[model samples]
Target: MSRTTLTLGPLLYNWPAADWRDFYARIADEAPVDTVCIGEVVCSKRQPFYADVIPETIERLERAGKTVILSTLALPTLDRELKYCGSLAREASQMIEVNDISTIPALAKRPHAIGPLINVYNEAAAAFLIAGGAARIALPPELPLKSISAIVAAARNAVIEVWAFGRIPLAISARCYHARLHGRTKDSCQFVCEQDLDGLDVETLDGERFLAVNGVQTLSYSYCNLIFEARQLESLGVSALRLSPHTCDMVAVSQIFRDVLDGIREPSHAMRAMRTICSDAAFSNGFVHGTNGALYVLE
Candidate 1:
């Protein structure tokens, strides 16, 4: 019953600025997570809304004895975006998660963390990042467990983190899906994505629920739940479980994970409690089992 650190990832949804601020404020004061990732990782357009509140949030989280890591945009296109990413790397913060490749050179000489968005499927890639000053690496959610184990062994000295919860961020594109859903182009999107807090659901041609469209990002319809896999991951020597921000009771979620990690509660009990909190969304551990990313394989 070894303890695994819990990290609160940056929010991926388009909630109101006040809601965003309030969520982190509560996290700083109450959540049991060891680290809290701040800043925008999705569309850059949403950055301005909460940008003013980030510094204060960082200060508060740090004062609460929680390690704060600033996350960069997953996709960088415009010159302004690149500049902003560079500024994030250069900031006095010791830890920053680089989601895009462009941030590598900008943060190469400095010490920083790497996010799951940057592919690290093999040991060589892990070594490369570790050599480039990455103290920790959050493996991409799409990677199978075998690859994760291999990377973890390779990164013996570096901290290894996994996406433990939330809707999996499957892909990103220059086009805004919200605009496409509304029959408008990206250039004239008019910030339509702000309407959906948890992202707009995208269905298949046969009317089956498939994925979610959040501006430039594509996410899974099912939330990724790894509560049952906590023991397996701990046995593998994983350092942390990254819980992506969602509009749920995160403090309760963290408590459940803490209980599971502390051996005070069994995985089955944790899963049952999660069901009560996660609403109607299905949970999947398929990617970890090397199967379809959406399949829920109960052990």
Candidate 2:
């Protein structure tokens, strides 16, 4: 079987500039991913801290032979945020990953990618975006194999990518939960979200782990793991698998997925290796299995 492309997704958390630079520097030197998505996708307030380093990182990744895709904010409410998205859209030199429809008009007729945040639930939606010059569509993480196969079969012109690993971003709201939690207004948030690099874990009243909060975004508490479903996704015409960035050893994570795509590593063994790599993260495939998003379904 031909190898499925492994794309390293943009960093969703707010890491210190030094940490972020070192992380990508390591990725450039070692990771086996074909594409690497950069830019601040969660909160616009966090972008400026790392904006100066982006050009250098992109150059490094390009030198490393990785396709660097720039990702827009999933919820760009502010005028400046929208302008940033537009600026990214106008970058003819690189591919833009549109996370919101607000960025669509600016990218009209240009070949761009549709991030998972935009709801492309059915075949019609997939076809519509492809018609508008979407070269690739990364399906929402909650989709099942049935829906995935359906869209992939219908949208032959676009590369259908799936979220293969990392915390599934559930939703984004205008209200900043991180700011609210800190008892500060959104405007005076003081970048309090910087405290939790992996996002603040939200636990239920009953002491069970619930979701995670990152400013305006809500994410799954358990990291989405589809190591076993990789081959099935490949067989169904899925062209790429996205691995979301985390504080974990992503280079090793990318290698594991690449090994599976290359038939050099068995899924069972890959899962075992992942357990060692992401020792603190709880694994979940429930969304893909058509069950509760919080549950981990054993294969």
Task: Give residue 232's lDDT in candidate 1 (0 to 100).
Answer: 84
Candidate 2 local lDDT, 52-168, one digit each (tens): 898999999999999999999998887998988898798648999999999999997799999999999999999999999999899999898899999999998888999989999
User: Where is model 2 more than 4 Å wrong at Cα?
Assistant: none
Per-candidate TM equals 0.97, 0.98
Candidate 1 at 105: error in angstroms? Answer: 1.3
Superposed Cα deviation of residue 157, candidate 1 (Å)? 1.1
Write down the lDDT of every candidate, Cα atoms only.
0.88, 0.91
TM-score of 1: 0.97
Off by over 4 Å in 1: none
Residue 200 displacement (Å), model 2: 0.6
lDDT of 1 by residue, 1-299 (tens): 34689999889988788998899999999999999988789888888888888888888899999999989999989999999999878865558889998988877567788898999888899999899898989999988888888988878878899999989999999988898889998888888988988888877999877788889899998889999998789888889999988777999899899899888999999999999998767788899999999899977
